[model samples]
Target: MKSPIFSRSSSPLNSHSSISPPLTPRRTFPETIMEENIDYATTIITKWDLDGPTYRKMSSLFGDDRKEAKRFIEGVTGLRNAMHYYLKINSSSEKLIRAQRLMQVAMKRLEKEFYYILSSNRNVLDAESVSRGSTRSSLSDSLEDEVQGDEIIEDGNSISEADKASLMAMADLKSIADCMIGSGYGKECVRIYDLIRKSIIDESLYNLGVEKINPSQIQKMDWNVLEAKIKSWLQAVKIAVKNLFYGERILCDSVFSSSEKIAESCFAEISRDAAINLFGFPENFAKSKKILSPEKMFRALDLYEAISDLWPDIEMIFSYDSLSAVKCQGVASLVKLGESIRVMLTQFELAIQKDSSKSPSTGGVHPLTRYVMNYLVFLGDYSGVMSDTVADWPLNAQTPLPESYFSSPISGGSAIEDPSSAVTVRLAWLILVLLCKLDGKASLYNDVALSYLFLANNLNYVVSKVQNSNLGLLMGSEWISKHESKVKQYTGNYERMGWIKVIMSLPKNPTAEFSLQEVKEIFSLFNSGFEGTYKKQSGWVIPDRKLREEIKLSLAKKIVPSYRVFYEKHRGKIGREFGVESIVRYAPEDLNNYLSDLFFGTEVSTSTKTWSSYETSSESSLSSHRR
Candidate 1:
């Protein structure tokens, strides 16, 4: 009932280029030398031919044992050298040309044969896509039909046998990929594994009888078949990783090394394959049209979380616990994983920024910023582990510790001061790093107000989380206070910058020169400021209710009294000269109401009103400010 997996190899055409001597001075190599070269090239071409059964014979002898697989893989070095020698050598002779074509054939054959052998050995549990009794040729034909816009066979039983053969071929390819990993070809093994998965997924979807799986077309898929393919693909990858670790001592050694490059490679491949499956095909793939779904994103996060939760198991698998091998208990691995996740979050943030920028109507916080900050919140749970691991870290000489951060009793006598402070300070610094990154994402907003508001909200959220969690201990109270100040700074900047023009319009200290002409100018200034600010800010939104209140109150404190005093002193006097009511365009009460409406984003009418509500609000604001 398993779905069939398929694979194909594109054979490169033979190309020729050779340098010739201008003068015919025939200095011929010895016959023995020429014969030896030809024999070596021929031997290489023969062994390299997967279709010739040479590799199959070797695999049968080597069996599935890791040690033997390594040995058999090593034996291919000579054949590889010969093939390279044939390809790189300068020759236009018929013999060389013929040999090159043979080499190409041998390569294609090996590719096909290896895949089939591996598939057969694995008993591919996902062969449901392939019809029973189909040949490779027929599978290729079916692929062509699908590509040519032919209808898909809806019946599960009608799945082509050629499809099954292709799947088997893919299995054989994975087996070879396993051998590659065992042979210390870590990067190459990863590449091969990625290619194999992409091929299977691409083929299955292509044969699924749909151009693209739109929302409406999603129901057309045979869920059982798709699920089987997904399960088999994931299981195969797991098995490959297990084989690589358990079978080859060299692989185990490399994977568990201090550098952990091999482990990183494996994880990268796993992440990529998982992402492709869950998130849909990358843009390069044909018929790739899946929207970024929430389910896929959450699943991706879950995969990362699962890995994070099982860090100890991963360490054990790679023998990271060997006392002499590594100095720390899984700290290095965890740090590396954290770094990788940060990179993913950065990419997500950029993507969100790009999409949001394209649509100007969208308002409020971006999901990318939320997702990354939420992830950091979860990551904060491990601050204790991180702090403990790096507790004895030497103080950074370049960046001296602040005096305020050393109030702990541990700072009493020794010049060295609190050791725990070093870890905690850096933990705080790391949290700041995420905030700074989120700030960068917020800057991508087209609306300046939205950008600042986004930053304020996120920065505020991060500070709260860190102070509330164990991360606070590492970062210390001083660190939390510093970031809290920064959030306030942002809010302050938003108020001051956005309303600078409006504030500037208020009259300064009245002097002897403040006559009827100056009074008219002051009224003019007030009218212009009210008109400009109301028009500019009316449509802008402040999603957080508390932030809105704080912003509005701050504005009222700055504008209410200045306007109330200016209007009371000058309103009647200026109105008489400029025709009474015309000169006093807006009353003191009108100024208070306008200030209250500042961040509420409500519309304002420019018509004149009486001063009944002015004294109470202005007195209250002035009293609060004095306190």
Candidate 2:
């Protein structure tokens, strides 16, 4: 598609020498008088004032009369001053009143006069064209020339004079909106936008003609300057929001109460500011008297909740794709905003890590964690647009627009059809990445059981979250199954390490009668293994009940039954004077109870014999004293 602003024209404006005859250069006009008011006015208008040569051409075509040019320039200065005064004061009802009067009266009169002058010169322009025959190069050159910085004339191809007047009015309104925003009158800026949009809808700009501009044709006007100004303001807003929330201050490792509050306040402030200034929502909504009487109060929308509700509107505005006929800067800025959001979220994770390092017990649910998850959830809502923005974009393409990004009808509700699916899946993957990082932190603990316990808790929390939310669908059932397996694996790890000694102490079935010394050795090994394991793990804690039970039951299944069988068989064979209860230390039921207390700080005996010497002692004691 052709560039929206500077598409290659097939008319004389861009035709080659073979297609259009070249013409001799005409004498240029004398330098224009520098009208101070005009110069200042142009700043607000943000468009070019006609240059000396172009003004001379226009002057010549209108019988050397500069009356219309002078009037239009003076009117622009008056309009600019009025807008400036309105934006400068806090309560400028008087200024707005005057500005509105001038806009409707003085501005409309100037537009009609300017149209008259242009209309009067049409016949002279046509006569000149006929005399020049096919030598159209002069006309093309004039159209190509930049008058003031950004202004241009489009040769014989121009919109209706009424359209031009309306466009110029919009340009002035845009400047006022900018000044209002800069002066911290965000609400006033919104008001100005509302006013301008209302005027457009009412077709009030066409005071000179009864014909109104088609809403569809509003883009024909040069809105690039106005859009650029508004977009730059929004970009600054986004930057301020980023710095306020995720800057070095929030990333600091301080543990003060105020320090934590700083993060919370930053989030609230940014969310509010972005909603009002960047996304253009009102500060507060008015409620009906009846509703207010019943409740006595009303709650404002939550920033995150409001974002979720309004994201489709936001996406529609920011994800605009340029076409051959329309161009918007919204897409570029939106991509930049998304990138910043992603970076800020990453920094939040880093802060959590830093905090956890200082206090390992800082593993509870945190506001930062909640906010990150909320953002990820919000991203899921628009992941379709995001996925297309990143992947469907062509490499090094000349045009700024990606083809049919959100508008494409070829989607099948898959990742390709719904880019949001990919983004949702990516967020799920990010959660896993976070779990892995937390797992690495867990491994730093000295107690192997405690480390495994920490890992199990984190993985379980993540899987539960995915299961309860749309994240599960995006990640698919398989993803949940995979993480569930990880949770089980961590549980197994804790049980295996915590019960290894007890597991190895189980005695085999006795084939012959054993001596009293043999019974004493076997019981001593059980005493040492169970006592040592219990002592080491007594202070360890697994806060998750379900996981703790799973670990306990698993250890029981491995060692308890074996110990019970070995004890029953050997009870009669040993013939020891000491009771079997004293030798065995733990009955099968007792072992089960001990296993249940594995993670609840269970008590351990003070004295524990070493199992390593049990083998040597069995033989030596058997030789010295037999039953």
Highest TM-score among the candidates is held by which one? Answer: 2
For candidate 2, the 10 contiguous residues with the lowest summed lDDT are 291-300
lDDT of 2 at 22: 75
The parts of candidate 1 lying over 4 Å away from their true place are 1-367, 382-458, 464-474, 510-513, 575-579, 601-627
Model 2, 585: alpha-carbon shift in Å? 2.1
lDDT of 1 by residue, 380-487 (tens): 454434333345554342325454432222345342455555445544444444555566656766656556665676667666666676566555666678777887
TM-score of 2: 0.41
Best by lDDT: 1
TM-score on alpha carbons, each prediction: 0.37, 0.41
What C-alpha lDDT do the candidate models reach, one value each? 0.45, 0.43
